[model samples]
Target: MPPLSEILKTTTTPNGTPWLTSARVGDGYLLRYAGMADFILNGAGSQLTCWRVEPGVSADTIRHLVLDQALPMVLNRRGREALHATAIVTPKGACAFSGPAGSGKSTLPASFFLAGFGALGDDCLPLVEQNGSIQVLPGYPGMRLGRDALEALSAASGVTAPVADYTSKRRALALPSAKNFPREPVLLSRIYRVVRPKEGEP
Candidate 1:
């Protein structure tokens, strides 16, 4: 079950995690974080509110709140599960990679793009059940990577594609537009999880 934040208007510190406290205000949720901006996410997640308590906060912060946090909640309300995964379209079909942070979920999709594949989604991948089978939804047409990560991709064909500003940790680039990476949901063909091999392993 989701948190009862909508009912518990006050008593934010029932526990110790301040970030988890959410209150309802006129059919919306307001989440406050110490030393950071308070985010007011609408019940439907169509609106976002942020009030920065300090400087140096970038607009990307709010974007993440909408894309990664609020949007998922909205999807959940519609009976969908948002997974922390990155997916790409290949000659075979759409493939997704999911794992913890620093698990190369983003980098693997970036590599697929450089290798002449199309990216379907990055960071947040949506899954839905249809006819008793699970399928992956088409997502944003960009991959987020660091500036240094662009070196190899830019040199792939000497075209030197430009990377747009995305977030503090990465750059965003438009993925290829073609039938291979169509902007429509496709049947999930495969999923890979990248992990660090223990030392002494081949």
Candidate 2:
């Protein structure tokens, strides 16, 4: 692992804010959400750039500035569309879950992990084209679960970690209890659309 400065070199745009001098890293890339929005790549020019500031500077903010602002820049630069869902790859194909906030997109995928499926991504799922197939980036090793959702997962999987130990900056759980933690990104597969009914509806 390299230091943040070594791995990422900061540069100031004309307007004057720190942006990454180089962004690409190995098989993956880096998207910086500092003052302004910009994608840094090891290759030539930037894939995208944004002229907005994300909501919060704290690591615990739920309203992700990266997803809200930088994602569009990435999509436009890469010529892709954004999808609001969690993506998991199975033997059959890619599966994606899409719904509004609090619709269980995060918890349902945890169930999949307990069922022996690999963890793809949670919350912000990116759509990418690779090898003639549309693939979504597997999420980093993290899952964001509310109190109730966390308790339910604890019951079913018998895995529990301290809530305080989890950070909002990254969706992560350090569990020495059940020894269940995602180490890698799952392949993109199926797509599931989740819908929650209103106060009264069929």
Candidate 3:
């Protein structure tokens, strides 16, 4: 049982939360999120080791945290271009939707899923380049779409999209909580960035 302190330097974040810190640990990165899940992502960004905190936390919450933070960070450091994008697998190939916050990144991919394509993930897509080819490494299979987005999908398809999980103003839009993600990597085809026109212009 090697303690994190022996393997890496420690630091504190002043964000009034228990997300202690993840530092450059020996040949890897260490993470302590919400003072619960203690984990390490190996230098290759291919392996992870995790443990529960004293009182334990929901595995679902830990999974979400790892997707949003640790895994992306590790992959980015390992030379993959981690995009702030959502991705879907179309018949042609994998397509990415990238933009800043509030740019409908999640909604667009969800639309593709409804149109019969498969969702790679709704956020945190990593592009791995090899031998002059780019591949879309899938993220967690889920879409965090707003209420209106879900409603629109339901109405258009005439099927009530199940809410996999609850958030503040959105629901985790996936069958049985998005943990059922596909693993096959798809070749990169196109990436579309969302842009909105001025209110009075269009």
Backbone Cα, N, C clashes tallied per candidate: 1, 18, 0
Better of 1 and 2 by TM-score: 1
TM-score per model over all chains: 0.69, 0.54, 0.67
Q: Show where candidate 3 strays beyond 4 Å.
A: 1-20, 34-36, 44-46, 51-56, 155-183, 195-202
User: Which candidate's lDDT is highest?
Assistant: 3
Candidates 2 and 3 compared: the better one by lDDT is 3
- Evaluated against the true structure, the overall lDDT of model 2 is 0.53
Task: Give candidate 3's error at residue 113 in angstroms.
Answer: 0.8
Against the true structure, candidate 1 reaches a TM-score of 0.69
Error of 2 at 163 (Å): 11
* Regions more than 4 Å wrong, model 1: 1-28, 42-56, 155-168, 177-181
What tens-digit string does per-residue lDDT give for candidate 2 at 1-202?
2233434455664568664454545443556655534344333324433333355444333234444435544554565666777655466655778887678877787667656565555666666677777766544435666767766766424433332222332233432212433343334656788878887888
Clashing pairs in 3: none
Candidate 3 contains a number of clashing pairs equal to 0
What's the candidate order when arranged by decreasing TM-score?
1, 3, 2
Candidate 1's residue-wise lDDT over 130-167, tens digit each?
77777788877666665556665563333233331223
